[model samples]
Target: MSPTILAAILSVGVSAIATEVDSPQTQASIAVPANPDNETFAPLTPIAQIPDNSGDSSDKILEQINHYSNEPNALDQVTNVSQLRDVSPGDWAYEALRSLVERYGCIAGYPDGTYRGNRAMTRYEFAAGLNACLQQIERLIAGTNGVDGGDLETLQRLIQEFEAELATLGARVDNLEGRVAFLEDNQFSTTTKLSGEVIFGLAGVAAGEDVNGDDIDNVTIFGHRTRLELNTSFTGEDVLRTRLQAEGLGSLTEQTITPEGDLFFAGATDSDVVVDALLYDFPLGENTRVVLDANAGASDDFASTVNPFLDGDGGSGALSRFGTRHSIYYYLDGAGIGINHAFGDKLELSAGYLASEAADPGDDTGIFNGPYGALAQILFKPSDRLNIGLTYIHAYNRDTDTGSQLSNFRSFTEDAIGNAVPTSSNSYGVELSWQLSDRFALGGWVGYTQTTTLSTLGGQIDRGDLDIWNWAVSLAFPDLGKEGNVAGILVGMEPKVTDSSVNIPGIDTEDEDTSLHIEAFYQYQLTDNIAITPGIIWLTAPDHDNDNEDIVIGAIRTTFSF
Candidate 1:
């Protein structure tokens, strides 16, 4: 009846309006170059310019046809196609009927193109259209429920499963959002201090065995101890300050490894890794601040020749088992740079890079090797009373090539085992500290390492693999006396966790055992620019058989700061 209904009834309205009405040539003929970037490309041809007739139809049918006509391709109905035979209105009718034939295959074309539109009274053609409609209706009915009549049921089920999974994922995201909000609402802050002590001591002992049935006077030169440490900060920003110290440098040969063992040094020897000072900070929005003295020239652990690694309290005043720390070297020289920053005080971050040069070893050049190293650290203070920090260090030493000159220090009979063993190594450390009050504090540390070679032979031979581990704990008590006096005690033990052996045949690869460390200290003000410090330490490590092995030393030190 109407143009729109006629097209849909034949199903030709959908296809002809889409392709024939939206022609590129028609649009280009009326085009102005206004919105070129988003313009759609379409086929350009004179046949695509046909106009649609404005006729009446059922409102639904008319609306659908107009919508299809506005799409990309619509107007290229009859003239847009190329054919061997001439096409007329009858050809358009035949092509419209072909859409149903292609999908359902229910009808066959006549032997000649006559009576196709006007005389379609044949039962066979009518039956074919009925068959096509019945087939499409049956397929639609089967697809109405959860399943399909064809094998496409599997595809439908898969789509449903995907939708369920998407809903579950959305629920999980909502739960995580609630948890994150709760954590951000309850965040708090913590503060902590970073401090440590390194002591080096030297004292005389005898050749006979002590009451403990161990060697008393195998007297040897040793680095009684060394310590590096930092002060704690918890203020929601980056802050860095450090005080490094080394003591007991002048008195090296003072302890016995065995009863009659030869002396490690004829007398006092040189110290290698001395103390240096670095102070750095970041003031709110200001740049990082640093105050370092390559040569502070103070005295004692912080200075040179005037104050050695030891503090002169060696004999009867040695520290008990309750107050000792690991040993370190004094008179040693090194230079370093430090950085400190804080992201709001709870997460404190600090790092340092240090390099220590070789000190001139006196007569026994082989014993005093050249060592270089780097150090870095990060600390976290989540509350005002507790602090945690981690430290990383790397060190390297050149092979001491002149072994013959230091024969008196340590003796070795090479079952071909002794030689120059240059090594490079890294150490990692973690510390936890707590301040109980203004007058008391406690802390501990654990560190592991696969360090440089602990030499056996002279500087000529090397045994590459030597691993080590270190650990400790300590407590400090302050304000024991008047305003100027202070006291503290510390005790810790570090046991070796490695089979202390090198690749050598017929040589006894002694099990590297753990060493026990202890220290005690008391400080009194002597003057405005000076303080007197008396301290003692005891160190013990077992032999390969787990026997008692120990060394005891003491010292007195004076410090000045400006």
Candidate 2:
């Protein structure tokens, strides 16, 4: 029993002992986010974490390992033989078990609630128990207090009987120890992990026409967006992230006179990889977090958009840019800093400022003078499934980030109200998300921005304000067809100039009508690391003008993550 059980336990258990002794930790399973900011349904967790090397390995492994058998599976440690219900005074090995329990304080390796002396124990199981007893006895010999002579004699006899088995176990453990040390010495980074996502899309303008009656091109294009993230946690609680991205997906909005059909993942890097995002987030106290973005930071990085299921981040959520989050969030981007403070479980506040030219050193082009957005928001959560956010943004010289060029600035308002003239806007938005049930959710947002032309072209025009409005409603079905599937429908109005005081072509403004945007997408998680989404977007008007023909954009996207 001892020879077989002890060998099996020690052999397989040595690797565990080596791991424990070296204290090389495996990371806790915190699903690595496809977009690290998001913790919910992030993606396949494959990155290995190097744990904090601390604590005693031998003590931990020794307590659980058995000799040659693996079957003495127990969780609780028994200090007294009586704690093991199967053992009685009439048992033949009762005195030996009592001696190990009370004298040397060994035998804590017993499985939970049993002492099955009648059963045949495997080598793995014996080695596990033997490992614990050996460690306890070793300590006794090293201490000056000395062990009891009678118990020592009994231990000596047992040692003599298992001397050959013990020698083999020692050699195996030593070899494992060397292997563990080698791994510890060669690991790449103890503080950093790499996770990435790659996306391939086949997209095209399926239908449309310009206001001038020109037919839209129906050419299909294949493109890709790839991102690799370097996530570093300096203090375990704080994270420093750097994202490198290469995106070639063209905006389908380019197919029409309006930008309403632009894909959320669409971007032009000219196919060259660039540093897409860099930020460091650390906790200030128990409920406050501070983030410093050196480049390409968006408002969603800090403020609560309140639309969890649709904050696309390019790959995980919706398909169109307008479908991702409130248009107000698009105003806050570039380099910036932000802070989030929670008042309690039900309420929170966030504030941040970003500058498009924060790095420019020239006069009138630096952080304070360049295009920038300052934002403040209040988030309310009445329950685990509902979130509401009220947001306000103040900006100078920045256009609406996800709208038509006409909506970006009052069209024909002399230099487009953006290029030659400085523009100032105050935007307000309200966003709400409610998970109605495990399978269904509702979310939406309404945003309004009032902009005043700064230049007025040297008194040629009045510095009147323009009113722009946009809103959308979404219905989300989670696990629609499969466990990891999601189907979503979005219906909304694109940003349109409802009332413009800025003069354009002999009138205050001719901006009229509303452009309706309807979109639907179903993301099917093909595997832990892959998702395929097919979606379509319909635009009712080319730039809030019914004179233009309606347009449709179609796409099939595939995403891979690790």
Candidate 3:
């Protein structure tokens, strides 16, 4: 018999008698020899004993092999026995193959759809079939469907073992969701934000020699100031700021000084709330901006003040206004409009007009009627650490005194005979600041003003031209003791009557003496939004006369912000 026919007959016999074995001895009993031609077919020994000469049987086996090889193997692709064209319900392996194909999607059929179960087979064919079945079993074990009772039990056991880890992951996801909801619900406004600050101050002043050389007793006072600001932005490049403030601190008792020694937090002594500032600023182009100030202060529209450490009102700087900036900045204190244009990042031009009574229509009041101050300034920043400003101001009837001894020109010109004087003045100033290191800086400004009396009523009393000058140097230590802390020292002459030729016949019209103002302060940051500052100011020869006793001002201020 041909080897190919013998192999086909043995394959059919093996399939016909195949059984699930539980022991090695049972598997060995049905195992086919590796080479069927050389070794006897052990599994088929009991089934039939082949005759030495059996040509007729060999011819029958060859014909069967040829027929099976030519037929299709429908079980290779069909999902069910009913889809097969030739397999019958009586086939021995029909139920097993159907179960595998339908449950695991492992089977594929030939194009003709016939199950050629009588085909000869090789060991390679057996390996390919086993591989497909094993892969299908793995898919059933991993997924949620088409699993038997044993597989379902195994998946449940795995889920129970990892229950704690799964619960932790779910809880983390829930926490993130809650945080997002809270942020969305509690946000303030889409285009605007509200912020506030409250300052409480304990201040005391020891009066120096009065005008008559009498010693005045020391006075102590407590005061509070609160400010609420709303910052709104329509476009990303513009800002609208509205601020409301209330304060109740009376004026200082000692009044002979030029700047009046007003508390930094002093405002309406009756504790009435007022709109302190209303300003809208928008970009004109890439390098220019226009500012509309319904009510603006002198410091509102200026660039850097040269003395940064002494500029803040109640929080982190000098307690006295005289120590903050040059007296020339005191020329304007009410409503105004301004513009700022930058030439690259190093230079800027700023100009503004402010009228003290811009909102009043009474005599000597109104936007352009009377009592206005106009200013123009050119600010230059040559490097990251240096800044300079050249400023000029034309003021009408605006007080120049800011509680500093050198600012007596304004007091001398206005408070002469207890009547307001119609005066026009022109002021020129130069301010500069240099950062010497990461934590130390030096700043100073020199200002000159020429006042012209315009009232005819003061015919020869105090009418003429007056020349006033003031200069100061400031040293600042930023982050002195810790981050956000500052220490500052100011030494300067307040507005001084440099040369006066007032034609007052019966009164002394010449001012030949100049006084020195020395101030020191340290600010300590208690928290991100809170600070405490302790400051002291000493004036030698106050009121432009060495005969006056030295004046001392001390204050402790606490500020809270949100």
Per-model TM values vs. the true structure:
0.41, 0.72, 0.67
Kindly list the per-residue Cα lDDT of model 3 for residues 1-562, writing each as its tens digit: 2222222232332111121111222210111122323333343342234332223343454343233323332223455757656555554445444544455544444456654445444322322233333345566557786456654453343234323333332444366579868978997888888999998888777657555577756768788888899999999789899999888776563444345344556555677888888888899989888878888555446445666677885555877767777778778778878888899989989888888888898987898987888888898999989999999999988766553332344455445555555778999999988989989999999998888878755463656777877888999999988999989998887776667666655656555666778888889999999999988888777666777777777888899999
TM-score of 3: 0.67
In model 2, how large is the Cα lDDT of residue 214? 87
Write one digit per residue (lDDT tens) for candidate 1, span 1-562.
1122222233321121111222232310000111113332222221123232223233533343334323331111222222212223344344443443343322322223212232212111221223233444456456753222332342233224233322333444466578868867864423434454444333343233342355765453334334455544556464444555554443322233221111111222343444445444345355333323243211112211110111222211123321222211111225444455566767655544433442335433222245544445566777877777766666565211111111111122231335434456666767667777877777666666554455645544345554545555666655557555566665555334354435445544444444455566776656554556666555554221235545555545444433
TM-score comparison, 2 vs 3, better candidate: 2
Badly placed stretches (over 4 Å) of model 3 are 1-180, 253-257, 260-262, 403-414, 458-462
Q: The CA-based lDDT of model 2 is what? A: 0.71
The TM-score-based order of candidates, best leading, equals 2, 3, 1
RMSD list, candidates in order: 27.6, 12.4, 24.5
